[model samples]
Target: MQIQEKIAVVGGGSWATALVKILSENGAEVNWWLRSPEDVAHLQQYAHNPRYLSGVRFDLDYVKPSTDLAETVAKADWVILAVPAAFVQQALTPLAQDAFKGKTLVSAVKGMIPVQNILITDYLGEQYGVPAEHQCVIAGPCHAEEVALEKQSYLTIGSHDIVRAEQFCRLLRNRYVKANPLDDIDGVEYCAVLKNIIALACGIAHGLNYGDNFQAVMVSNAMTEIEDFLHAIMPLPRNLTGSAYLGDLLVTAYSQFSRNRTFGNMIGRGYTVKSAQFEMNMVAEGYYAVQSIYELNKRLQVDMPITTAVYHILYERFSPALEIDILKDKFK
Candidate 1:
């Protein structure tokens, strides 16, 4: 597909808003799908996302907001899925396979589907028959709040087809955003999921009174944990130290804007899982990711102490303090 082809962005969250902001910079007429017609109307009227990144206004000339999924997807040659992973299935349920046919699909969702235990790319292929070549993953050391501030940020776009990846990157790249192309789409997407789990662990450590000294060690070990798990599953030749892997981990683990970390902080501070989720009013993807990884590991059985600790605290109803105390013995 050409850069001039009509593009659609799915979802109405901060990341989706940031992406639409990036697209608007190029003066592209973007078809956007939101579940709430009220949100669509608000965006159209105010030229800004009502719920997220409200400070970043849009150019109405470049945005066509709609609530109809099939109509929006059918109109665009490229579709970017930016919804929270937990909601992506529901988001796509209304669209038939024909809507995705011949469309270049990009996944900005970092978390996996809990029920399927697969990557977003994999899920689309399985559920909608979208080919691997048509799929791409957008990963970041970038956050929406920072993008809204016009700060320089780097994004790694991973696809089996590097040319398509580069084309999509061109659509997103600008003064404040730089995009790099890579062939390890599977590895990059998996790292994106794994890092959030690690970030939650970092936040929990901080809330439990663990200092930077301990966190530094945990993060270093988290990197190793991520490498082990991805390599075991994909066995690809990859540089896990790259920005898409390590840099993403560092930012999410420490960023004040990370919802996963914030969620873990609440859990560390003694909020029950349900209570923490309720209070956050945001999806902490790592909470779902840790469980998916735990189940996937039942067969792979990689020795992931960090993921196990998170899984225990999140799923097994174990005390975060006790689980953390036990986790300390595993760290070097």
Candidate 2:
């Protein structure tokens, strides 16, 4: 007889709802923490998340929805952080330093901590004392909208402890979802962060009327940029061509569901940063990530033109056309 896995999914977003669906469907008891009390009430009453994925229903017996962060986390052995990167600190602020003392911390977040410029796994280790071996990162070529529709999706679990990563993978694998475990946690996490910036760049190019041919060249060059940045930061022995890295980049850069790309399209189409954000009503992780990565590279001095171009257009208030023109000259 196998023991049931109790998992806590922290966030009220589509990704968090999608994760709760996967785990609960796989027979794990899910303690879902949504910041909105109304959303929690709706999920419990309707067996569906009102805000994000309303179509996918949950089995209430296996999924417990809660508004209390601490209580949600207390009930699970594995806690998956799926909230947007900008809100992560605020969301977990209510917990004590040792609150995650013996649990496995999994980060489904793909952006760096704003101002602090650290990965989610690093923040977990520093703030909550969760050791690296017990921490994991969820990488995609996967999307929440696809998961809700039961479309084929693949996920990569990156962790320092491969065995523990594989254990979590078992909970995620199902009919339409395939989960694989990789040993390079930091490398995978960094690639996830970088891919969003690339996606934004692609969106900017598209909005500027740069056709598929030009975007293809830009994406190819962006891969080289990702390789350079990853080598400088982590210097791990890993394959960048793998689905966790390249596949994820391709999807985010081209997918209609990518908020970062949508956010960038608005910028390229002549919307101000604040205006784009206000209109979308969603957090594009790359908006926060570009600033963090740009500042970090000031010390590391990595040649990240796409990241630099995004930071300039977003933060320095440069014209998207001007920046993209300058950026294209540098790409092969």
Candidate 3:
């Protein structure tokens, strides 16, 4: 008998639940690190995800949801970090002592760290003691909503090591999922985070009943800003007008499945940021990411007009109506 490499999924959220489903389909042994003992016991006892990805059930045979981080990643060959970017450091810190030793680490979180103003991978390497080459950033136009449906979605598994990127892609690729490889880790991560902010702006336009033509222009202008922003951070090319960039922005900005878009709709309908979060009971990456981008724009002296508008609407008591008009003017 041969032993297969184990894959541990860190986080018990919707995205984790969905990825577990896909990883199981990929024929890998999965250990899901639950948020707490209570979550582990509840799912272990009921075999269902009641809190986050409701209506989806995990097959417990090769999948074990546990609260023990050490036990989850102990012998796993590949560990996927699926927690919100806000919680990535905290989640990985407890295991930093001895667990995950010599294991490949992959990140699915898109938002940036507020203090460091860097992507999760950068923070992982700079602050978390993970070897830079061992870190792989899985990015692109992927949304958990599509994964939950077992629908086809493409991802760019980016790393400095092309061989490792392709290896992980082989582990993650599936019928409904295509894993493409990329050499630009920072560029992909930046696009992933900024696209969320861009989408929040588009969602506001949509909730205000702005038509498609208006949104097309808004998204185009936002992408241009994103291209400029990406080039400023990483020397990667700024052809963000493509699928990985535009495709993701479309789903995040327009889809009903986007939590950020949903958050935007609520805000456009007269809900505060805090209230919107409490109502959703799920992590809207954009809500947490806005703080980082707002500070970045101020520090870099770069004009991320959309993020600035969202920051005003969210914190400064600027009317969404006024913000919308001001944003529209920037493109013209």
Candidate 4:
């Protein structure tokens, strides 16, 4: 189960680039898939990703860059899917179901499959026929920006199989990075999705002129909502305060590196949804996650007031100010 044989990182975005940097730093042979030929050529010629995490350079000899998704994936023993959740289906669409058969699939995505309203691992399993044992998720308080700076960060490798988790974890561990393997695959992945939505709520609060006093209460309430939702949907015997859950939530909600928070800030500052999305030029994840979770919760019936408030403002066109006012009453 060791990932040293061959590993492919499927995406060229900041997270994907950061992963490439980490793997390359470990001197592991990496097969990289970026959508653009121009970008691939740029990486080859310049030893760095042209679009995202451009500051982190790679050792050219240790990496192979490709635009062929199926071929790249087929060659790897492990495939780390780092593309945006929205484009994941499209990126892997060229591959046949059997392409992912024996390879371990690692999800570096934090968003849901919008069409299926399911976690990325579930989507890969159902859509691509990859088995549950073959799937893993990378959850974090770790951000690509921080990773690029070589700042200390912690990551949780969530999988049902501890062997696979430990193998992947070994590849990610280094001086500035710490990796832990967890058995709570469902809870970890679901919490990763939930936290992005909560971060958006926090960002909206900040943009709408809510002080630190209210923002503190809002994040605390958001954690309870996360606990309630995961407990109902997953029911795993796990600590919600751990880095994968609460730590991830705090970083995304408070860090300047969070795109979800940036998106919500724009919304709160009077930008339309289309405009905010357009200006960012990157998927916020929470924008899509809120819809998926809102629909999923219709059946689960979790008491997620913060999530509901975000859903109303983002999807139902409710004013951010009015929604926050209403949300405050639910928090205490």
Local accuracy by lDDT, each model: 0.90, 0.92, 0.79, 0.90
Scanning candidate 1 in windows of ten residues, the lowest lDDT window is: 1-10
The parts of candidate 2 lying over 4 Å away from their true place are 1-3
Clashing pairs in 3: none
Please provide, for model 4 over 242-280, each residue's C-alpha lDDT reduced to its tens digit, 9 standing for 90 to 100: 999899999999999999989988899999899999999
Which scores higher on lDDT, 1 or 2? 2
Error of 4 at 199 (Å): 0.6
lDDT string, candidate 3, 1-332, tens digits: 11255999998888788878778766778999987788888888888777776666777886888888878888588889889998877777766544655888898887887677778887777765678778788775777767877778988888888888998888777778888787777777778888888777777777777778877888888877887777666666555656667777887777778888888877877888789889988888887687788887775667778888888888786898789888777884
Best by lDDT: 2
Please estimate how well model 1 matches the true structure, expressed as its whole-model Cα lDDT: 0.90
Poorest lDDT segment (10 consecutive residues) of candidate 2: 1-10
Task: Please report, as a residue range, the 10-residue window in candidate 4 with the lowest summed lDDT.
Answer: 1-10
TM-score of each: 0.98, 0.98, 0.94, 0.98
What is the alpha-carbon lDDT for the whole of candidate 3?
0.79
lDDT by residue (125-172, candidate 2, tens digit) is: 898889999999999998899999999999999999999999999999
Alpha carbon deviation, residue 114, candidate 1 (Å): 1.4
Model 2 deviation from the true structure expressed as Cα RMSD, one decimal place: 1.1
